[model samples]
Target: MESDKIETESLLENLCVGLPTIALKADIPTPKWNTLNPYFGAEDITEIVDWPEFNYNTIIHRYGGILNSKKIDCVDFSAPWMHTEVWHKSQLDTRLDELVRPHIIRTLRAAFEELEPQTQQLNLNPVTFGHGTTAITIGLFWPDTSFTTVAEGYAQGKNRAPGVLGISPKWSSEWRHSKFSNDQHHFQYNQTLAELNFYMDGHGARCGYVLTDAELVVVKRLDTNGRLAVSAPIPWKTGGNGQLSVRLGLWYLGMLAAEEENWAL
Candidate 1:
């Protein structure tokens, strides 16, 4: 299993190394994309990855609208969810349904189309999103994941201890002292972490995300240890390379979702 993991990681990186060229070759339409470096804000997440394959330095100048921050303008800035921070908890579902989920789904669809079945060696399915309530967004990957599990997992979290983003469950305040070590005080200690973990577990998903409208966090289940490789809150409305960082990151995550268990941890 250890040797397989090593080979899988190597293959994963090698396979992903050509994604930029693949994305570049996909002439979906016109000159509508560009490149940017990924921002790594989470210090606790080990094996930090810089997706240089998707960088324009290697491939063509743009990523062919699949990762275009300026070209594909699906976000409605006038909507309430359009702001940097989604202040209204009730409308969180609207943002996911109307904006975030659709964009990422398209990204995955575009990504999957670029790969051959022999290259991917996995059956891809229609990616979608749904949940019982709007407290969190749940991804429905290939083979159709259940929404009840999402609701139940989220309910378990709420039942254990109510938490508001940034206030509880190891947000910015706790992150100041958060450590990478697997101890009692690891990132998985709180109720919110439990919710995120169980939510992915229910879907049998290895790749997931936590998008609070203010900032985005990428969560990857590493192993059976219950510890996740989660990114720090990256401002999605605008990032270091403008909005491209979050989109590219999310696109990479979408690729991981399609790969499912085949993806490297």
Candidate 2:
């Protein structure tokens, strides 16, 4: 754990602090991080990273130089403008493919199954890149699950970062019966809803993310209008990119190996 902690610190400093310093250093040969940055000064980048003596780090000092060495073919630090975007994108995607996909799939799958069967639709829903995708809400509706998810929010000024919001437990017998739902799990949804409220109140109009892995199970408000229509659950394995199949294969392989290993043990 201690080693893990050190590695985590190193990673944070390297990615957040060191890399930006190197970028600035390359851009401005003056060697001062603050002067190097075209947009914000070096101090601002340091404040964001919260790193001390960032410029003194060997990794930080040698970033551009090491990449400039003709020895490395794939990494082209030669182009001042393209190095950060091109190489950084390729490197991150490669690493995430190797590391993040498995853990992400496993964690989401377990959370989905532990929930009710219909809730499993969350896993099947196509993941979109904007807003509320990350801020997930798990609401309880007695014997069922129901929720309302916000899509995205507009950034403050121009193109900064948009705030995302979510609303769960839109209305349930559990909520209506009591002024405040006492169930711990149900209340957890309420807590999230409150936080989202603050975010929206501070920011602007919060939009709803296109519902994924969800069917409108209960529609109390629009009783006279009609019943809620739920899109048929998309098969977990069939999709345009075939990512679901790949994830399923990985999960199955993991289970088979675990079972075999258990027997041997």
Best by TM-score: 1
Compared with the true structure, model 1 gives a TM-score of 0.47
lDDT of 1: 0.37
Error of 2 at 59 (Å): 48
Give RMSD to native, each candidate: 16.6, 23.3
Q: What C-alpha lDDT, on a 0 to 100 scale, does residue 254 get in candidate 1?
A: 44
**Worst lDDT 10-window in candidate 2:** 207-216
lDDT tens string, model 1, 1-265? 4453222121112112211100111232322211111321123243422223433232224333333322222333234434333324334545455544455444444444454353335643323233433223334421111122122443232111011222122233233245655343444323344454555554455556554434446566676446566555545444332333444555555444444344324
Instruction: List runs of model 2 lying over 4 Å from the truth.
Output: 1-180, 208-265
Q: What is the lDDT of residue 92 in candidate 1?
A: 50
TM-score of every candidate relative to the true structure = 0.47, 0.20
